[model samples]
Target: MSMEKISIIVSKGSLEGIYPALIMANGARAEGIEANLFFTFFGLDAVSTKRSGHVKIGAVGNPGLHLATFIGALPGVSGLMTRYMARKMDRLDIPPIPEFIEMISDTGAGLYACKAACDLFGLTKDDLVPQVKDIITVGEFYEIAEGGQIVYT
Candidate 1:
């Protein structure tokens, strides 16, 4: 039987969007499915080593900003929020984003940086996350996206 392949296209800059793609992609691999992730647009920052660590919890102009800021400002709320996100993933049987990305990479799920997007952001291949398998054009991604489920999160 052919393996089930799922391609996740991550395009947002928020933690909510970034984490879900990583979690789902990794969850697919845990079940022995072939999963791939294409990071483009603002989503590229989520995977960039220089930017990933600085990823902000949604706040200021974000719909959830108040809640996120409240949680972030509360004593121990930052840790709590972090744990809450992790727990939510656990409830869904998915792993945390960082670990999920690691597992997805380790399991051979294709991880790619969008070259055009990268250029738009003034980023070089070296600026991307180390997990990136390659820098590819949209056409290349479409080639892989063919005949497979494509998800944008």
Candidate 2:
């Protein structure tokens, strides 16, 4: 069966964790599949105007980092790795998070923030990036996701 739509649930706050959802959403849009991104829990950081740019890699306890846990926990390690990855992604022509969000939005994909998470984090609609269409409950998300595949990233 063809995928007419997709609903991506982004629940991670780390740079690495957030990129996959962004990429998948962008790719789906490029393929002419209706796409939506639901930012919940820690994932809300990716849509936070104040914190998006500062989101760092979670080096400690991240198996993909390949560094010893103690070494990964060292001060500046997460920042250093985040910069390195960002530079590499730039070289590969990947736009930064904000730009990527703009591009995806321009493609007519939906972007939403979790209302519960926003309440827990003391964030109002103004606290999120302008691209976010609305802050919604999980029930609302599921309603919108009806007839589409829901992917948790």
Candidate 3:
């Protein structure tokens, strides 16, 4: 049976937060399912050419670290976590962010930037990566994902 269309919204800029949305969109495309990814607020970083590759994992206040929240904020700790996450991705064979995004574009998955978000952030199409097909309104988003799953990340 054909999989249903899937719509994913990514509102966070953190690597750990964004990866699930990215991976799911890629997974849906690989399975021949229609997928749409919408970026809003800070999530725009994922589709912004200048920021896409630099989105980092947040180590602060992480429950798994078992450290006081303040320790996570130590100057080098965030970077350390980012590097460690990168290594883990490397071990798991997850491609770097840019390549993964391009793969989604090439595979026919729809990528969109929220219209109000773009305006709110004072951004334009030129600020976004080439993968974004359109800057769509909330109504347009709902229209695209009609009858499909709506996942907010």
Output the better candidate (2/3) by TM-score. Answer: 2
Please give the TM-score that candidate 1 achieves against the real structure. 0.76
lDDT of 3 at 21: 97
lDDT (C-alpha, whole model) for all candidates: 0.78, 0.95, 0.91
Give the per-residue lDDT digits (tens) of candidate 2, residues 1-153: 899999999999998879999999999999999999999999998999998888899999999999999999999999999999999999999988889888999999999999999999999999999999999999999999999999999
Q: Residue by residue across 56-114, what tens digits does model 1's lDDT show?
A: 44543445535654555666655555566666768987654556666679988999989
Candidate 2 off by > 4 Å? none
> Each model's TM-score?
0.76, 0.98, 0.95
TM-score-based ranking: 2, 3, 1
lDDT over C-alpha atoms for residue 74 of model 3: 90
Alpha-carbon error at 24 in model 2, in Å? 0.1
- For model 2 the TM-score comes to 0.98
| Clash number for each model | 0, 0, 0
Off by over 4 Å in 1: 1-3, 64-98
